[model samples]
Target: MTDETRTSALQILRTLVGSPTADFHEGQYEAISSLVDGHSRALVVQRTGWGKSAVYFVATLLLRQRGGGPTVLVSPLLALMRDQISAAERAGVRAVAINSTNAHEWGDVVAALERDEVDVLLVSPERLNNPTFREQQLPALVARMGLLVVDEAHCISDWGHDFRPDYRRLRDLIAQMPSGVPVLATTATANSRVVADIAEQLGGAEVVTIRGPLARASLRLGVLRLPDSKTRLGWLLSHLGDLPGSGIIYTLTVSAAEDTARLLRDAGHAVRAYTGQTDTGEREESEGMLKRNEVKALVATSALGMGFDKPDLGFVVHLGAPSSPVAYYQQVGRAGRATENADVLLLPGTEDRDIWQYFATASMPDQARAERILSALERERPTSTPALEALVDIRRTPLELLLKVLDVDGAVRRVQGGWVATGEPWTYDAERYSRIAAERVAEQQHMIEYETTTSCRMEFLQRTLDDETAAPCGRCDNCAGAWYPTAIAADAAASAASSLDRVGVAIEPRAQWPTGADRLGLPVKGRIAAAERPLEGRALARLTDLGWGGTLRELFAPGSPDAPASAALIAACVRVLAGWGWKERPAAIVTMPSRRHPQLIESVAAGLSQAGRLPHLGSLEYLKGGPEGEPGGNSAYRLAGVWGRIGVPDALADDLAGLAATKPDSPILLIDDLVDSRWTITVASRALRQSGAAGVLPFALAVVR
Candidate 1:
């Protein structure tokens, strides 16, 4: 390249970095040169905050100055896109994004693109598959694209810690690009395997990989093996304030994040909960709040993991170990990016394994379930997700996820009517998927070793990333010997115990009946009738709640013996009742027969009846056998499993009639050991309403969310 062009690129880099003093990192210039001068595909694997953005931004400016088309950046998260847009604007690069959250602005963005006003066009990976966008906007962008930049590129590879199926569509996008259009894929978390896989996907023989050292000298990592959840909560409550600056608290589940945020807030910390359940607006606000140091921390799940740029983040504390060391490295890398000496701590829990196992298979498509769904979706008529659920035995969550995988794989097509089976033949690669699952198991074990290892934590994480330059830094608890507190104050422990012991989660009634229930011979569809629906119910706690969750999990775990409700659980249930804000109190109690935990349900019913001065009007009887519904699965299948299995027994009907005669419009409380899918309660309540009950209010020991 000519020195004049190099000087111009450096000028753009200076503007992008916001400081004339700032210069390119080790391989930043090389990557930028490759994309601009050579116009070659490059893969840059460097540490977080290593200015991956600068390389693209500078290259985009230089290329645009040379009369090239706008750079098309395929970002993974909306949050990341927002950050990139802001950074690009600061560099005087006109950038705009087209994502789910900004449909209203698409026209303006398109106009800007047509006017050649946009230097960088940011889009999510999922946007590539959008029918309207793909059919129209995307093809134009691809044809005129100057540079195709894939951020968090490891997501394209199944071997990566956080593999996203949507990212796999990038291969097609890359192939569609003009030969001379330079493509750059960047990530901080890929190991050799993931790197190789991503490079192969990018372009087998043409990809240029630029890797750098992964060690972070500013990060001081450590792990605390708390005996249990309560103790771990206590430790966090006590020491969260002691951390260096405003930062994040990572949790394994949404409930944990919420619970921890609430407890920490009650203790006078300004914190907020962030999870996949959090709305996009709130997530954006929370990210801004964290960036500006308006909140102490965002107690978040992996939803807040990638593309969140906060350079001065003080610390990152994990309530439970992440499933993979590579993932842990990515999260903890969020801290100490531009700062010196940031704290990173992990409070490993026994429950971590269970949580890990739950998520490990989240993306692994089930072969039988996939086949069933494909077979159910006739080619002639496209089937809506709900209708398909009714036709297939798969649950809604996994089923929807599987459909996306299938849609990306070309096995199915989502059209106006819904999803329809494509004529293309698809075979589930059982061996590859099984091997990936096994790799995940190994990764989980590697995380365990990360927590327990008596060596430099940073070095261990670096090694996990396959960084050749990984070596011990004179930091971390292992090297420095206990840089954090080991004790939880008595008052803090008491506060944490109180927070965790508190239980009660509102159970929302199913507003709409599962679609195609009529086709299943049940004659139910669309919105459930208000008269037949159970009132907004209450459960002692959600099965996912940090408080009472562990105990309930133990009680409901497979092979757990059915037993009477314990005094503590009964008290907790009573507390849930006391807090219940029903207009009219229940005058009678009817237990839902538990085929698995009859004694437990009976004991809870008996206790509530005795304590609340309500009549115990016998249990609802199963006519032939219990409802076919098991604990888990999609709503339609679960409803089908339990449909017509439960009925109001004669004695219960007689008692209800007599009670109605005495006190008309009296509500009857239905007790059950657990509520999952809520179909059992729905079907049972409909039966009671048909049998002349004024109102049915369902209560359960736990709600399986």
Candidate 2:
């Protein structure tokens, strides 16, 4: 790095360390500050407690003080925005967060900006696309913008920690701003590829990387090699502090999160769980307990707890092996932040690799399956599951599995009534994700290799990242324990060899549904109130009468941190009805407007779709993930959006006309699931003729909207 760039990077961290709000350790400050310099746009690639947020917040304040036009911070989460703004305000910097929460209060922010009275402004990404904000307000105000900071910049790069195609547009928006308005992007983890992608999108901005030694000297790292999830859970309880400080247990699934939390509570921990499914209060309470040391541990999925800070957190233990090393590092880094002597534990089981493989591969639809979906859509018609079953020639088992992949990708939606296409068909672009996700997955594989190797685990990580240490990292379990280099060395070698011999991860095996599962495909026609009910039986029966007509799988919700699991079961049943081609409907979708910020909607959509299900988290997953303007999964947001806008047969007919008027290429009517709604086809056909979406064909299966 040039001396000037090196100095500039150093100064950013130094400035934060020197701030009245903080006096971080010299080395820690250096490590964090080192990220600031010449990288016009960079993802920080560290964990929550690594002081990454401080690095950027300080940058904002500094830029503002230097007469930088008010800095614009697009936070991925409302909580993160509030936290940063609160911290900035405490440090005597004027910052305000504008969101749907205080819809009317925005006048003050506008007044302050007009008066040049504010130093920083924080907003969720959706706020940027707001029709009024985009056309009328921001153009004039941001014209004088000094700096643009995207807190979770990963959202912008398809390769970064998170992938959001819509996020890719930020680069274009930022580049259009007046020349002097610099952009700073930061994340906890981004490999060389993700960094490169971000830079490429950022008008060819240069990247300045600050990856220091991997070893946390004062923190102890331990690995528990167990045989299965059950045994691992037992081990976690044994290690439980039996104290108030919060610890988190990482699980692979939302259902797992619920199950684990129940197990812990039954074991007498007064514990709670958070996933993409828990209620807002539940999530908030779980976190609150952690911050207040009211609960000793929390069970959650991999994506939870970004931008959450709890100094003096005693430990972070993973009940599962995360898919990648970057994820592991981020998860474990949660501990040892407020003090030395904190611990991080990872409980590895036999199927750990299998689980990782499931996420990576299951996420990518098989080529043949993708092709089938495309062919069906090209014909401008929605096919039933049975129809798809014939086309793909797979046993019902594998066909069901492929269906989930399509559902997650927004290619299809399901409901109590049937299923239909919300948008275009599935198109695989290996260049879009495989390379980046592989690199991310490989990093985790490398960690497994390193841990299994005879050499010290800490030493391996440190030596790889910082490149100076050949000596052992005496602090790790391997370095101090009996499993050191002897037999482990041989095993790790074999593991690496086997890893190289295999093909990349593939889709997960299908989960078994009930024998008499009544189902449908998208293009649902029903009342939104169907999903709003809490009774599974009523929901199912109502959906069936509306149009649903397929055998559904066993409905099982292990816990109810949100509503009774019964309510969730009904929602699931209704979705089955919608996804199976019940009818084209929208009113049957928006039972209620979004009660949370925007970000949660994103996470819910992405999380559900990732699981090979549709993104209709409804009240259950919505409260669990957070609201709009909160950081969430891309898959979830899209699903919720489609589901939210769904209407009845009449409404679907109207929207069909509306969309046709918009003239979507090869326009087709969307349905969640399908039943035999008489009005659906006739009304849809009339609407298509009226508005003119070329080759208009309504699509759905086990009907959902």
Best by lDDT: 1
Top of the candidates by TM-score: 1
List model 2 lDDT by residue over 1-705, tens digit each: 456544544555455445434454433344333333332544455434666666656655555645667878787755466567766765556888888777788888898889988878888765775556767778986788866777766667643323233365576577679764556666655555555666676666354444434566656666767654445555555546442256777776664566567666765766777776676556666677777878777788864655666667777777667765656666666676767667666776555564576466644446776666545542335566655543443435445555544554556644322345657646766675567666756666776875577667656655444335336767778777742111223433443333222211111111221121222232433332221211110123221110111121111112312222233334443354345332332211211123322332333233334343432313212233322321111222222323323223355445545554554443342221222221222233333334333332232222211
**TM-score for predicted model 2 compared with the true structure:** 0.57
Model 1: lDDT equals 0.88
Task: Give the alpha carbon lDDT tens digit for every residue of 1-705 in model 1.
Answer: 689988888888888877887778999989988999999999999999898999999999999999999999999888888889999988999999998888999999999999999999998887888778888888898889999999999889885423567898888888898889999999998999899999999898899999999998999888989888889999988888888889999999999999999999999999999999999889989999999999999999999988899999999999999888878988998998998879999999888898888777666788998999888988878888878888887787778788888888899987776888897999998887888898888888899889888888888888888898999988899998999999999999999999999878888888898876777788788898988989989998877888799899989998999999899889889999999999889889998887789889888988898889888988888866777745667777788778888898888888888988988878899998888888889999999988889899999889877
Span of ten consecutive residues with least summed lDDT in model 2: 545-554
| lDDT of the structure predicted as candidate 2 | 0.51
